[model samples]
Target: MAISIDRISKSYGEHKDVHALREISLSVHTGELFGLIGPDGAGKTTLFRILTTLVLPDRGSATVEGKDVRDDFRDIRTMVGYMPGRFSLYQDLSVEENLRFFATIFHTTIEENYELIKDIYVQIEPFKKRRAGDLSGGMKQKLALCCALIHRPKVLFLDEPTTGVDVVSRKEFWAMLQQLKKQGMTIFVSTPYMDEATLCDRIALIQKGSIMSVDTPENLLNKYQGDLWGIRTEHMYKALQDLNNFPSVTECYTFGAMHHAQVSGLQMPAELHNYLDRKYHKNIRVEKIKPTIEDCFMQLMQADEREPVPNE
Candidate 1:
């Protein structure tokens, strides 16, 4: 295993304390691109901080390539490259300076590890003299990534790296990650974007500080048990309200241009559709649609309400 986390938990503040992670246990195999899928404040950042040795966990243990997070933090830091959610580089320093600075911190020169960052470095080299604060969001992200890879770390940790970037930048960023995996590096990235989950070799679906399910994206889609339909009416609000009250309806929520609903039982009859059609008093469209990862995540959230206890 490249990464092994056994019942890890973290929290913050005092009385009326907030529990960040609750007994979260997972492992990432060597040279795999693993993703933690969840929304903001869902313990993703907390988990990354603990694994990167920036913050200590309140309970349980974690290991990176068999090195304990708490006991062997120094060794872990040297072996892993971490790009935090927020850009923490020196604003006054130029792009080249930032990359060189990090290399120096690890007792290595940029030239010594230039080959490792060659692919990503090429994109940022043209703006090497630009101060980091003057760079665009996408450019800043590239610079940060190049700095992280300069030391040739064995594993990489990215916390919502593409969150605030443009669509083009996001695409370019993932391309860089794929190239790294080919170089035999283990990557652990966290993101709230559902579409991006499919790009990983394996993903952990997480929410409310707990893991709902973990599997290959294809397997998770295959395991969906309920029939889902895309439904839309002239009065969308009323349609949602009425569907939620229906005895046969298992899940009803707005999804983009239409409302995606799940029936509690197998095969919704035409008569049932007619009933909803008349109730809405407008021409409605009801068609069976393949469930996406977001649909699966919604189903998981509706099926459970238990909050994670610290280190359970």
Candidate 2:
């Protein structure tokens, strides 16, 4: 395994404890692109910090490339490249200076690893002389990736790299990540966007501090609970309550542009349409729709709320 975590846990507070991670255990295979998928405050950063040797976990153990994060902190620090969620480059320093500074810390010059970063660095090369603080959001992200790759570390950890970038930049950034993965580098990345989950080789869905599920995107989608139907009426808000109260609806919630109702086997689209038609609803549309990662996440969250998951 490139990364292995065992029953890791962390909490903060003096009088009242606030848990950030609860017995989180996950494994990333060698040279694999693994993603930590969740919403904000899901302990993604806490796990990253533990693996990167930035902070010690209050419980459990972890290793990166067979080196213990606690006992081999120095070796792990030198062997892994980490790009934090928030931009952390020296804002006053020019792009080139920031890159050079990071390169020097690993006892290597920009020339030594220039080839590894060329594809991404070239995008921001034109702004190499610009102060880090003056660059656009996308440009800043590019520079950060450059600095992180400048050392040519064995394992890469990126925390929400596309959080604040433009849509085009986000697309470009993932493309760059695909290129990097092709080069055989192990990457562990985290993002709150459910849409990004499908881009990963495998993802761990996390909420609060616990991992809800771990599987390939396809496998997760295949496990979506019940038959899903995309439903829309002239009055969406008013119909929401009606849909939820419908005897055949196993689950009902508004999902972008329409309400998604996971109905029981006894209900058909036409039956649902007729039921709503009797209520004087107009322009009703009910179609069985494919579920997305967001839908899977919602299902997991609802299940967790109904019954507490036993720790493994």
Candidate 3:
């Protein structure tokens, strides 16, 4: 394994009551592109920090490339590259200068590791002299990734790297990751976007500092156990409330322009259409739709709420 974690736990606050992570455990294989999928404050950053040797877990143990995180801080630090969720590059430095700084700190140079970051660095090379703070969101992300790769580490940890960037930039960023994976780097990245989950070889869905499920995106979607319906009416809010009150509806939530409702039986769509027509007397459309990763995540969240995990 490139990374291995065993029942790790952490807490914050003076009373030690805020449990940030609860007995979380997972593994990433060598040269694999794995994702830790979650929203903000989901313990993704804390887990990344612990894996990169920046913080210690209150309990349990972890190893990176067979080196214990607790006992081999120096080795781990040298072996892995960490790009935090927040932009941490020096604002005063130009793009080229920032890359040079990171390379120098790692006892390497851009010339030596150019092959590792050429694909990413080329995108921002025209703005090499531009200050890091003045770059656009996409350019900033590219520069940060270049800095992380300049050291040419075996394992890479990126925490929510696409959070505030534009859609095109986000796409480009993932393309770079795919290229890096082909180069045999073990990449562990986290993101709140469910669509990005499908791009990874495997993903671990997390919520409120707990692992809800871990599998390939296809497998997770395949495990959705109920019929799904996409509903659209003139009044979305009212339709949502009405669907929630229906006895056969197991789950209902607004998804973009349509409301998705999970129901007990396949024949419920016609019944739903009629109910909406009689109640609201407006144009309504309800169709059986395929389940998505977002649907799978919502279902897992509901299950977790129904049976809360005890704090360690």
What is the C-alpha RMSD, rounded to one decimal, of candidate 2?
Answer: 1.6
Query: Each candidate: RMSD to true structure?
Result: 1.9, 1.6, 1.1
Per-model tally of clashing residue pairs: 0, 0, 0
TM-score of each: 0.95, 0.97, 0.97
lDDT of residue 228 for candidate 1: 86
**Model 2 clashing residue pairs (backbone):** none
Which candidate should be chosen as best, given TM-score against the real structure? 3
lDDT tens readout by residue for model 1, 188-267 = 99999998999999999887667889999999898887788888778989889888887787889999999998875756
Clashing pairs in model 3? Answer: none
**CA shift at 290, candidate 1, in angstroms?**
1.2
Candidate 2 Cα outliers beyond 4 Å, as residue runs: 309-312
Lowest summed lDDT across 10 adjacent residues in model 1 is found at 303-312
lDDT of 1 at 200: 95
Sorted on lDDT, best first, the list reads 2, 3, 1
Which stretches of candidate 3 lie above 4 Å from their native place? none
